[model samples]
Target: MQENLPRKAACIGGGVIGAGWVARLLLAGVDVSVFDPAPDAERVVREVLANAEHATARLISAPLPPQGTLSFASSIEAAVEGADFIQESVPERLDLKRRILGAIDAAAPADALIGSSTSGLLPTDLQAEMSHPGRLFVAHPFNPVYLLPLVELVAGGRTAPESMERAVALYGAIGMKPVVIRREIEAFVGDRLLEALWREALWLVNDDVATTEEIDDIIRYSFGLRWAQMGLFETYRIAGGEPGMRHFLAQFGPALKWPWTKLMDVPDLDDAFIEKIASQSDEQAQGRGVRTLERIRDDNLVGIIRALAAEQGGKGWGAGALLREHEARLRAAAEPAPAGEPLRLMEGEVDAAWIDYNGHMTESRYLQVFGETTDALLARIGAGADYVAGGRSFYTVETHIRHLSETKQGEAFHTTTQILGTDAKRIRVMHRFHGGDGTLRATAEQMLLHVDMGAGRASRATPEVLEAIAAIAGPQRALPIPPEAGRGISDLR
Candidate 1:
């Protein structure tokens, strides 16, 4: 994964996929320009970003990294100029892709990488009309880009090997696993495999062997669980046990020639099949809207990723490299102390899982509470994902917490943050936690350092952030450090 690199990117075609690409790129701190002829492109992009921000904030265990500025271009030429990378997410029509590439090639610099979000089209076919086809390739990402980490990178006939490498590096830097397709091929690897399974699934439903929902259940309840941590080959390897690879293949190979599927034949989009699938899917979805479903999906994905990551180790455990990149990003976005009055109040809750055997909140859960409280204060002071993407960040350097009243599970809590002091490189903050009854439950004091994410070290805060802190601090109350917290801070110091 690339670390602390900044690049300007342009997204061509502001549809669902295009907007998803914009959200992911901007959240990763890349300055993005978007262009689409649709009248509502700007509004659509804004809504997509908003949804992404909510999902991202909840999905991540750590605080989200800074986000980049978003700009809209009236023309394709204006969007591609000076961009380090261009993501093409226009309509799937081959002619439309050809025209867009032609325009981008004419405007963008020779060295800039251009990637298509095409699902099944060959990159070579898409780049046929480009003047500099070597710079063009496929960067197919799954839906809801902010949640899914997989990005398939495919190099076309004229695409340079270096371009592919750069693309991998670029996507990897942003916490995505960029699997490279060695040669130009239709549908690429993941999609082709999915298509194969989808064909069999359709046949099963069409032949009354199973209903659509039943087929889905079979995959989700069985293979999906195994696929989450270990992929197909590895899962089968484990299943074979002492028999090993050859023995495993021998057992399964015989079933391949059976009349199990019509893999070569395309299912006719007949009215009956379409209606059956549509009604079943709609029934399964129920009355929930698209946004609601998207949120649920994103939350599930986050839970799975977190479980995998934690199981592996502290960092890079399950997903390894990609998860590490995400950790680095979170570390870069920790809270910093504000200036002036410094005290800010924010509300939160003690999660049910944070309770221990006694049914009260555990000791470590207090730290998490204070941590979230600090995040809220920072977010209020404009220290959010967008802030970090601009090459500025905050890191916690010191912390002190005092336990007072023991809070039980399901109790609501509130935190008040106070800025103690500030300098060019560091700021001090104090927090007090109150239980549902407004009784002080705990107190915490911390010191944070401004950081330059690119340099991977302490650095001075930008004037904008400093000024925001100053504004918030000006009218706030003094740091009312509780007596217990004062002693705790003294001991820690």
Candidate 2:
């Protein structure tokens, strides 16, 4: 994954896919300029960004780069004027795309990478009209683009290999998995597979073999769950049993010759057939609006991705591995202490799962935040991985928490820590939790004792570690006392 990302981007066309690129770039701290002649373009982009805000906040633990400014330009030249990267997401019409891509190529700097979000169109055709055709390529991303991480990168005939390289790097830096289609074909890889399944599904419905809902249930209940983790090849390899893949394939491979699917033909979309399909689809969707359904899909995806991320720390799999790696990158790239300010050690918006019955962050999540804050502090003061590996570390022996305000899901929050006192055997620290507005949301005063893991007994920290702790503690000795620092339960004396 590329760690370096451009600070400015221009997007051509602000429809569904274009708006998605805008959200992704803006959230990643890239100032964006967008051009779309559609009347409702601004509203469409805003709504998608709102949804992106909610979903992206819940999807990860690390704070994102500061949001960048967004602007709509009247003309293509105005949009791509100083953009470091340009993306074209206009409709798939060949002529329209060729015109826009060519315009972007002319206006954007010679070095800026230009990407077209065309799923099936050849990059060669898309770039044919461009003066700098070598700088243009296809960068196809999945729907609800801000949430899904997959992007297919296809290089055109005249495309510079460096353009594809830069596209891969840019997509990876933004938390996407870029699959390179080294040899370009008509539909690329993923769409071809999806088309095959979709074609079979249509035949089944047309012949009254299965309803749309039934087909959905069949996939969801069976291969879908497996696909989320193990995926097709790995899941099948496991299912191959004690003798392994070759044995299983030998036994069942002949079934491919059976008349299991009508792959050669498509059901005509006549009025009756179209009505039948639309009716089934509407019944499946119920009464939910498009935005509402998109939110639902985003929520389900967030839950799945978070669950996979959790599994990554133990026995990792596909999506989980990607989630964990991306999170690690985010964490490593997070901002550090600014000048003399208390470290912005633990900062993240509340997760959707943290909300309780009262619609605020549950009481326990506050303590969880405090614990994460302490962990960050510990890492800073030489009690981190290496110290723990040496079989001695500090354990929270006592903690007092005061909740001054309720925190809600999607609210940006951070914690600042002050070292109250530290000696050879124990340390006392005070943590203040603040909302993005600087209102104190909670306070946690914790006392930690050094323990020898091998002996299971209290012990003094080594002089080196104690010196590191005191170096930080000494700087905060003059800080004013916090109001809730020494308070007891119910504010008892």
lDDT of 2 by residue, 1-493 (tens): 4356886899999999999999988887789999999999999999999989888877765657789899999999999988889989999899999988878887898789998998799998887898889988899999888988899999999999888888888988888889999788988988888889999999999999999999999998999988888777778788888888887788888999998977778999899999999999999999998889989988888888877865632223576567656665665677755433455676767877889999999879898789867766776677865688889988999999888898887788878888887888998989989997899998999999999999999999998888878777776777777777778877456
lDDT of candidate 1 over 241-328, digit per residue (tens): 7987778888888998998779998678799889988888888888888778876776567656756754532333445335645654
List TM-scores for all candidates, in order.
0.72, 0.86
- Clashes per model (N, Cα, C within 3 A): 7, 0
**Model 1 misses residue 209 by how many Å?**
2.8
Best by lDDT: 2
Runs in model 1 with CA error above 4 Å?
1-6, 315-317, 329-493
Summed over model 1, clashes come to: 7
Candidate 1 has what TM-score?
0.72
Clashing pairs in model 1, backbone N/Cα/C closer than 3 A: 65-385, 66-385, 67-385, 67-386, 340-473, 341-473, 342-473
